[model samples]
Target: MQFKKYRPYERVENIQRDWPNNHITQAPIYCSVDLRDGNQALVNPLGIEQKLEYFNTLVKMGFKQIEVSYPSASETDFGFTRMLIEDNLVPDDVAIQILIPAKKEWIKRSVEAMQGVKNGIFHLYNPTNEFQRRVVFNKSDEEIMNMAVESMQYLVELTQEFQGNVTYQYSPESFSQTQLDFALTICNKVIDVVNPTTDKKMIINLPNTLEACTANVYADRIEWMSKRLNKREAVILSVHPHNDRGTSVASAELAVLAGAQKVEGTLFGNGERAGNLDVVNFAFNIYSQGVDPKLDLSMIDEVKAMYEKQTQLQVHPRHPFVGDMIFTAFSGGHQDAIKKGLDYYRKEHCQEWNVPYLPIDPKDIKRGYEKVIRVNSQSGKGGVAFIISEFLGEELSKEEAIAFGHMVKQKSDEVQRELSKEEIIALYQNSNRV
Candidate 1:
């Protein structure tokens, strides 16, 4: 591998950084882009019916904003948008968003597709990085700025003819790679033309089209832009981070501390390349810290099942928050600590969740305690006692638990695997101690 082929990203300097001391005190506005960003990345994209199903699931999960489709890009996307409008499936509080390139014909088609929807966000994007300017579009800075300004003007004019409430969202694609000065200039120009008021605020989404630097650098950029954008109070600072470098979650969190008010992501980080930030992971991170995530994730299992069925993508068993074995304990030490914590939690009747090795209460997400501890070759007395107490309603003293633990360890070693709860129960039931 030629390690010298890559160049380091430029670092932000000379700015009085405040994000380091700041903390996220509230949940940001979450927008699920599962239907558009996540669906487009699939090898076989979802059909209209499947898209509708996913859309309904997101609405029920308490997402107030959802990017439903890109209407001008595909017939399936357009049809799905129409189906939601025609069937009146969208809730009164939900805002359905659609993405479109900053072009005349495409913007017109997007507007037409959203004719009957009550609440809509028309998302416009154009590539603004130096590479895209020199290599992709081959346009000068003045020309690129003109393109964004003209697109915003056209969108503003078209909204008057449409019958629903329409909000404007703009993204300078590849924003993490764009020069900070140029990115801010283009956004300010677009904002000037849009003339957003306090009552009707615009959204300026800074997307990490590709993760180009460390999470702190992204936070620095966000803070710089938030502080410099024209009419800061009249615009909602938003972020859409992709996980090319596996740091999208950190970037999103720091961006919030840096003054971002909105986040756009998929359910399980499913998107192009490494995918977008996982909204479930981000929200649950907040939930674990005693802050309300503002999303009803109690039915996480059902949500994961529907997502897999529609996307044909399996969730990793160790994925955070929704993974099957995320809260399970196997090591003897960990099992002992968790068992004691659970016992203390029940004995004290505590309202706050505090358990060793478990960040959040599994019951909060509809997970049961049945699989919290499993016996294996590394089994210990605490786990054996836990299994006996939980399954058979019996507790063993320290001596008995220790002796039985050794037997279970031997059995597990002979099988070279973890022992199931039922197998452990049978072994205990057949034991001379029983």
Candidate 2:
């Protein structure tokens, strides 16, 4: 957990006073979509070499399960899958996942991608919604249901004959748009037909691919399905949410609270429309709440680099915990608090010296950022006065603040700068910092 443990302190630092966590569960098991969703987002799709590099990078970063690619789409995709299987680069505990539609041809191609593998996940799904059926494919519910059944039937046949390598999986593609009861009935029926048990390990992924509804309602449906889906103990309940309405992260989080065990999304919210749930944000969220997110987040930079290579888009420095702005404090008062907090932390135990300077230390995750205690247009005397007195190893009085205000004005006009209190202090702090 990134947060500090409760101790016998006289003061109770209430985090809720600043930013409350109304969420019951902080994080879920992350299945990064950097390879599939991030790659697909780019105008120039990542090449085989680029894709392979990223694929290996995420695995190295300790992502045990990842959505590698969409097989049954093109030869380039097929080649990548073949390379993932042929190169034997997949780790023992790692499950290389592939997405396929609920069609016989697509299912076969998806299974073909699974050949000669050790332990891999085959994520098979079909459109079980009204809009997708009417607009995307123009298929009726009966037709869609038949396709689902037939595809699942073939998948069952294939998985049975398949070796110790393959694992069975399915998702009700665009499940959020489908009627809840119909989706549940279809999902339950598929479970009955497949009858995947502990011995024959399986997973059912219910993807909230479109953020068309409220998170609570979606979570209710997920919980209802998870509870009613008559499966043995070993079945893994997974969730994949798309952020069309900016509710994907909440939906994904609430799913775990509602009994989901696995989650799928792209790094930094890269996806087709608005985007997917950001796995990094999701991970740090839960870690702050005292739960193990099961991610080696120290390799966040490497994962981000791979994402950039896969999609030529620079990572936003101000995105979140990994963002450049995450650890920075622009306000002079804030910076002074941070500086004092660090100073006190150096001489005193953090538990003893309670301060609200930061949520988590920047260095804990290897980020090279400090509190920005600078004088700027929006700066004030409290900030400037603090920096001034501290740098000189003496306390600057109210009298000094008035005198320093002149020096601040002089420097501001000279440098064509705005001397915030801290900036003014830095400029004339006993000439040591200056």
Candidate 3:
């Protein structure tokens, strides 16, 4: 492989960036694109029943905006949209978003699918990156701008005759790769066509469709565009960052700090390639920082179970918040510190979470304290003592704990697996007899 063939992505220069100094004090508007972006990437896309169930789950979890599907692309997608509208499955507060390319026929088809919807966001997108323009479409800059403008104009015209509350959203697709000026210019033109009023706002989604650069660059670009965009009050600046560079969450957070008011993502970052930003991870990150994320993720395990079952995908054991092993401690030092911290927390009747290794208490997310410390060959005396106290309801003296920890380590090494609660208790009983 010729590793030297690739050049670094260009940097945004000559900007007085303020996102670095600013903090994300509040939650951004979250739009789950699981049914569209996440479904498209799945080996077996979600059936209508699964989609319906997932939609209901998302609503229950406090999502007000959901990009349900690209209705023009498939019969299933179109049918799902129709079912939601006809069955009155969509809630009054939730806005269902539909993704369609910025083309005449597709726009018409998307609009047709959204007929009778109470609240809908007609999301239009077209790739405007330099490579896509020069090589793929062979269109000039003016031609690209005209495509977005014409489509926005047509959508505005169609919505006038439509019988629903319609919201408009435009994405300069691959905004991360596109020149920042062109991205801003195209969004501004689309805004002009939409002519949004103060009461109603249009969404301009700047997506890192390929996630080409570092997160800081994306934040810089978002801030730069936000500062220059026309009719700022009448527009909702949104971001949809992919995890190609494994920093989608960081990019989204930084973007929010920079000026993005909304974020579009999937539940577990399930999308093409590395995936979209994990909304669960993002929300919980805020929750840990003492902010209300506005999403009801308290029963995260149930959500993970449903997502895994429907998507036929496993959440990685180390996945930020919802993964199986995220709260588990197997390392000796970590276990010891966690045990001390947890003990201090309980003894002090602390109101704020200040455990050493555990960020937010496992109990906060309905995860019990059972697996927080597990005994293994690497387990320390503190961990063994914790396990005994947790599972067997017995307190051990310091010397007894030290001796028992050695015996547990030897047994674990001999068995070449972690010991169970019963086995640890049996060992404790046997040692007492001796």
Per-model TM-score, in order, reads 0.99, 0.84, 0.98
Higher-ranked by TM-score: 1 or 2: 1
Error of 2 at 315 (Å): 2.4
Q: What is each predicted model's overall lDDT from 0 to 1?
A: 0.93, 0.72, 0.92
Which sections of candidate 2 miss by over 4 Å? 1-27, 134-138, 351-357, 369-374, 381-426, 429-434
Full ranking by TM-score = 1, 3, 2
lDDT of 1: 0.93
Clashes of each: 0, 7, 0
In model 1, residue pairs whose N, Cα or C atoms come closer than 3 Å (at least 3 residues apart or on different chains), thus clashing, are none
Candidate number with greatest lDDT: 1
Alpha-carbon RMSD, each predicted model: 0.9, 9.0, 1.1
lDDT of 1 by residue, 284-387 (tens): 99988988899998988999999999999999989997899998889999988998899899989999888999988888888888888988998699899999
Write the number of the candidate with greater lDDT, choosing between 1 and 3: 1
TM-score of 1: 0.99
lDDT of candidate 2 at residue 17, scale 0 to 100: 27
**For candidate 3, lDDT tens digit of each residue in 1-434?**
99799989898899999999998889999999999999999999999999999998999999999999999999999999999999999999999999989899999999999999999999999999999999999999999999999999998888897777889999999888899888989999999998888898899999999998899998999999999999999999999999999999999999999999999999989999999999999999999999999998887888888999999999999988888888998888998889889888999999999998888899878889988888889887888888888877778888888888899999999999998767888888888722
Give candidate 3's error at residue 83 in angstroms: 0.3
Ranking by lDDT: 1, 3, 2
